[model samples]
Target: MEVEIISEESIKPSSPTPHHLRTYNLSLLDYLVGYPYVPIVFYYPNHNDNDNNIFQALQRSLVLKKSLSETLTQFYPLAGTLKGDSIECNDVGANYVLVLVHGRLDGFLHKPDLGLINRFLPLEPSFDQSSVGSRVTNVKVNIFKCGGIAVGLCVSHKILDGAALYTFLKGWANMASKSEEVTYPKIISPLVFPAESLRLRDIFQVSYQTVLKEAALKVAASRNGVQQPTRVEVVSALLWKCTIAASKEAYGIQKTTWLNHSLNLRKKLPTKTSKDLIGNMMRVSSAVCKDNDETTLHSLVNKVHDSIVKVNDEFVNEAQGDEWYVAMHKLLQQMGEIGSVGPTEYYIFTSWCKMGFNDIDFGWGKPSWVSGLIGKGFKGFFNLVTLMDTKCGEGVEAWVTLDEEELKILQCNPELLAYASVDPSPLSNDHVI
Candidate 1:
């Protein structure tokens, strides 16, 4: 199916921002993000067919547009320009695009083509032209021939994270569906991770961009034992094992790989800090492993879970000091030192399981699937984005990145294939006509 861009416009805030809120300060945590624009897609299944269907669809679009403007008023910094270390909230507006597809959304949903998804997105999510250097966001409303819709949004990592994106999106949907009032987000990243002492750009330095061999791994949620394995616990354990196995087999050497998993700190923050406070509120906890035995699954899961559990309020609060920056800089130095030795690699795991993606109702309906633009960077791609099936409440989806050879080896693993199939979407089916 071919996707066509029908129209494009700017969606500005419905009201002018107060002069007091004109300049949005960038936090030290925001500076460390390095401006990677994360692209996410939401597929809403709509099969309405009636005389008023077309008119109703147009009405929904108009409603979404209006609510978006109102929602922008709450997140006014998004509609502004990034200048130096701050966002100039001058109401420059965000890009809004309307797209059309040649076929029904059923086929697309049944078999999602990631390459084709770029057509639905408003802009490319890349780090070259950083969001700080260009636009903060680009949103697209895709209307399929089947009357279904796909909402594509690309958010800059410089000012926002997954939590921020979810908050903004859910707020927009609430307004569109229930005409609810939008709450002003409590932006306090600077207070938590003050930029006064730790200048991320100045302290952190990388001499060479090392291209080490990497692999993506996955595991489904399990319920065999007394305790059902959470998505992050299961996925992290399996992926960590797979990374070790793939690295050793690919290079024919024994090496240790560092496994760093991100844990959200909103819940861990103090009540006064507030969960509603926006910005990148995530901390990374890491573990190193050289063992290749698959029998250690339970131990690895326990390790990852313990690492995540250890990120309590005290841990998050203490991490805001200079020691944290020194630790990160040393970690990078260690990574570089390790990479220079052999086929060893560093893998970062981010699990969006139990993310309440299915709860984001946008009047039409909840999206059948929500996906992140991960692994698009093929060269040395080392991160894993794990998603959950909100309806089933137990399924896990992992998009892993490995070189062609390593991927072929991973595909042959009978152990992994026994429980779950490898990228078995409808796109790979022969029945598609």
Candidate 2:
């Protein structure tokens, strides 16, 4: 598990960005969310023989850096430094770290040490004013003792979301092989989601983790034929249910609780945005569940679904209006009053299922695993759980970051455990390409 820093390199864009494309403005969604860095790791098994392993690793490293530089030409903003509310896309460059790992990749994969996995990451994300500075992205390539490699990338969430990152990863990999097939990501915020309207900030917390197994979710879905909860709905409801179960000790069934989740506004837009459209295009939708309410898993799912559905065409259109900002300004004053993370509050669930993250391939093979860490060292305290695609099949993995006690309560929850298991192996299938 010892990850030693062998060297570090700064990979500048292969082409100097045109002056006209230098300044990339922060979209409304970006300004509102203002999230930190999102850390993603990709593992590649070394295929070279022993003596040639070192030489091959160096060669692969060169390919990665060169391809990354070329990729930056299209994703120019990533290589630039961040200034106030915008990226100076002047081709500053991104951090690329080369590390030597003392352990084999299989050990960590077999008994997956989440902490050890993080050890491969390059930069530690921070929250200070200079944290999300220029050099919006970072790369770490860990060469395992067995010659396998793990490529860890940390991207500024303020710049893009998981979908954008996936497309970026593909472009970088394609360039590594010097392939010409590429799709330039479009910055359509100005046209679709204007920047002036994005004046909200990232507010909210608690620590917790829980998962909803695909089978159990299907069962839950079938029970209520009228309510077919997607994987995200099923998992969100399950997390709310368990949080309620765990909260019984502190607060009885008398208080009101909220389930705060994000809705992707891309599909909700009147004219569908191109899949290549990048930036944070999400809206937070809150569903209330008081103790007097049904409070059942089905009930929770119904509530969440309804709240999100309400954020439809009208709500999306309002995002471009001045009144929306006024409402947000008022909501900002009442943020603390709305709720705080105490024994009673809300859980924020962000789903990344079907984001195409599992499809990133750099010629070695598809990643053995993938995770989205907001680059925070320790887990936070809004019962935050991130659900992602298993990629092996239709199942999804709900990654919750809770303290030991609360997590144990969720882990031991008979109902949840029956459906969603924790940390299923990424290699447990015949589809690992």
Q: Pick the candidate with the highest TM-score.
A: 2
The candidate that wins on lDDT is 2
Candidate 1 residue 259 Cα shift, in angstroms, is: 1.3
* Sliding window of 10 residues with minimal summed lDDT for model 2: 203-212
lDDT tens digits, residues 175-240, model 2?
776566776787776566677735566643322223345655756754663256677777777777
| Candidate 1 per-residue C-alpha lDDT over 40-126 given as tens digits, one digit per residue, 9 for 90 to 100 | 788876767656644565677788889889888988888877677888888878889987777877787675666676666777654
Task: Name the weakest run of 10 consecutive residues (lDDT summed) in model 1.
Answer: 204-213
TM-scores, all candidates, are: 0.85, 0.89
User: TM-score for model 1?
Assistant: 0.85
